[model samples]
Target: MRVDTVGAVFDALADPNRRTLIGFLAQRDTATATELAAELPLTRQGIAKHLATLKEAGLVRRRRSGRETRYKLTPEPMTDAIAWMATVGGQWDDRLEALRSHLARGEH
Candidate 1:
C-alpha cells in the first residue's frame, strides 16, 4: 500500500470514536449510521461523516442495503498499521535490552 493511504488509515483511527467503530465492525461485520450512533455519543449524521472519512482513508468499505448503507472494517489497512507499530516497539525493546546490558556491566 502507498504511504499516504497507510497514514490516512492511522489518522482515521487516531480518534477514539473511529477506533470503536472499527472494532465493532470487526466483530459485527457491518453497521448502519443509526446503529453506530446508538453505540456512540455522537449523532447519526456524525457517525455517517466519520464513516465517509474512514471509507476515504481505505480503512472501511461499505455496501448499500436498500436505503441504508452499512459499513465494515477493512482489516488489511489495520494489519499494515499494526505491523508498523510492532516494528517501532521492537526497536524500543532492543534499545532497552542494550541499556540493561550496559548497566549490568557497570555493576560487575
Candidate 2:
C-alpha cells in the first residue's frame, strides 16, 4: 500500500467506533448504514460518516443495491499494515535478544 493509504488506514482505525464498525462488517460481510445504525448507539448519519471514512481508508468497499448502499470489509490493504507491524515486532525482538545476551555475558 502507499504511505498515504497506510496513514489513512491507521487514522480510520484509530476511532473506536470505526473499529467496531469494521468488526461488525467482518462478521456480516456486508451491511447498510441503517442496519448498522440500528445495532449501534450512533445515528444513521453518524454511521454513514464513519463508513465514508472507512471507504476513504480503503478498509471498506461500498456497493449500491437499488436504493440501498452497503459496505463490506476489504482485507487486502490490511495485509500490508500487518506485514509492517510484523517487521517492527521482529526488530524489537532482535534488540531485546541482543540486550539479553549482553546482560548474560556481563553476569559471567
Of the candidates shown, which would achieve the greatest lDDT relative to the real structure?
2
Worst lDDT run of 10 residues, candidate 1, spans 1-10
Steric clash pairs (candidate 1): none
Give the winner by TM-score: 2
lDDT of 1 by residue, 1-108 (tens): 456767988789888888877877778978998998998889998888888988998888999999989888887887787877788899999999999999989964
Clashing pairs in 2: none
lDDT of each: 0.85, 0.91
TM-score of 1: 0.81
Which tens-of-lDDT digit does each residue in 1-108 have in candidate 2?
Answer: 466777788999999999999999989978999999999999999999999999998999999999999899999778778877788899999999999999989964
lDDT of 2 at 77: 71
| Candidate 1 C-alpha error for residue 51, in Å | 0.9
